[model samples]
Target: MNLELLESFGQNYPEEADGTLDCISMALTCTFNSWSRDGHKLVSASTDNIVSQWDVLSGDCDQRFRFPSPILKVQYHPRDQNKVLVCPMKSAPVMLTLSDSKHVVLP
Candidate 1:
């Protein structure tokens, strides 16, 4: 997979970044979910009850969150860079604060 970073983005991303995102080693296995507001990070959610954050430049997973249920989607908060909203298959949506690893279920 080639990830093309638009020139307008003004990042040092190579014109043609090759290979699947390291966040999800096997792209076919997990959902390539969300990117951070700054485009510096990636989040992947999988049926294996895992959520992972990866560094875009290094392609290294920086953090991992595990839940009891499979996650359908993971979205980064629009304004809070350290927070993410997670939607699970069989439970209420959750708000995760990366700074402190707090898990709060949304009402």
Candidate 2:
């Protein structure tokens, strides 16, 4: 990942940009979300417990969802573009519905 490219996304610190790249690479998750239906948005979850939705065209964060603990992994719902499944350290996996701002704990 190019640090310069990530820095363009409003990252004020080099460490943060590096962390974002690490998360994207480690997770191998979708950098582009289908939520936009236009391939103009992306999502990334970092160990810092923040899930961010980004605007691909503008290089801005569309929204950020924070959790109580460090995140272990993140997965998006296969069909629900507005939803993401996050596994937090020492906690149950949660289903976060972005559109409605609902957090559901999975058993």
Q: Name the TM-score of candidate 1.
A: 0.70
- Residue ranges of candidate 2 with Cα displaced over 4 Å: 1-38
In order, the Cα lDDT scores of the candidates are 0.86, 0.71
Candidate 2 lDDT by residue in tens digits, 1-107: 86776555664655544443334445534322334444666777765568887788899987788778877777667766687787778899998887878899999
TM-score between model 2 and native: 0.59
- Distance from true location, Cα of 3 in model 1, Å: 46
> Model 2, residue 20: what's the lDDT?
38
lDDT of 1 by residue, 1-107 (tens): 44564335665776785877457474547864898899998888976789998899998998899889888889999988799999998899999998888899999
* Cα-lDDT of candidate 1: 0.86
Worst 10 residues of 1 by lDDT: 1-10
Ten-residue stretch with the least lDDT total in model 2: 28-37
Which has the greatest TM-score? 1
Find the candidate with the highest lDDT and give its number. Answer: 1
